[model samples]
Target: MPAPIPTKVHYHKQARELELGYADGQSYRLAIEYLRVFSPSAEVRGHGKGQETLQVGKKFVGLKDITPTGRYALKLHFDDGHDSGLFSWDYLKWLIDNREANWAEYLERLEAAGASREPLGIEIRQL
Candidate 1:
């Protein structure tokens, strides 16, 4: 089967989500933070398998912009200064299909690494 092609893409600033509409009538709303952590760049995915880096302290990270990379992918510019990942159409579809599982795995990894999603110096102090 051929991969689904995106028919429309919209970034909702207030919701901090990238809404994608595909040719197969499927749509997905991906969070900015999710895109940041799961970036397909070498900085995040690393040089090879088992070399994946854990991204931390990006709970509030936002998208600066998203530019198309030819007809195959998108280059996302992040507010936190990460701008290397090329988000392809197939990869985007995969992300939408596996969002729940991927998010759970990310949470598990974060917990194992003793990392917090919250940005640095921002503490949730209880009164």
Candidate 2:
């Protein structure tokens, strides 16, 4: 069976959710943070297995832009200056279907690494 084509895509800034409607009568609402942490970029996925990087401190990340990528994927521009991930239809569907399990794994990794979902802060002083 062919993958379902997206009929509509809506980005809700207030909720930080990306809602997608598909031709197969299915829809999904994915959070921006989820998308950020599970990005398909080399920075996140890395060059091969066992090299995935843990993305932290993105609890409040927002979408800056979403651009189509040659009809097969989307280039997501994030407010935190991350714009490398290419989200394909299959990947998007997987995210939606496995959101619960994926989130659990992410949390576990964060806890194990003593990391956090809250963005870090930097203090600067005047010279």
lDDT of 2 by residue, 74-119 (tens): 8889888899999998888889889999999999999999999988
Predicted candidate 1 versus true structure: per-residue lDDT over 35-114, tens digit per residue: 99999999999999999999999887878788999998989998888999999988887888899999999999999999
Model 2 off-target regions past 4 Å? 122-127
Location of the lowest summed lDDT over 10 successive residues in candidate 2: 118-127
Off by over 4 Å in 1: 122-127
Error of 1 at 120 (Å): 0.3
Clashes of 2: 0
Error of model 1, residue 89, in angstroms: 0.5
Q: TM-score for model 2?
A: 0.91
* Whole-model lDDT per candidate: 0.89, 0.89
lDDT of 2 at 94: 83
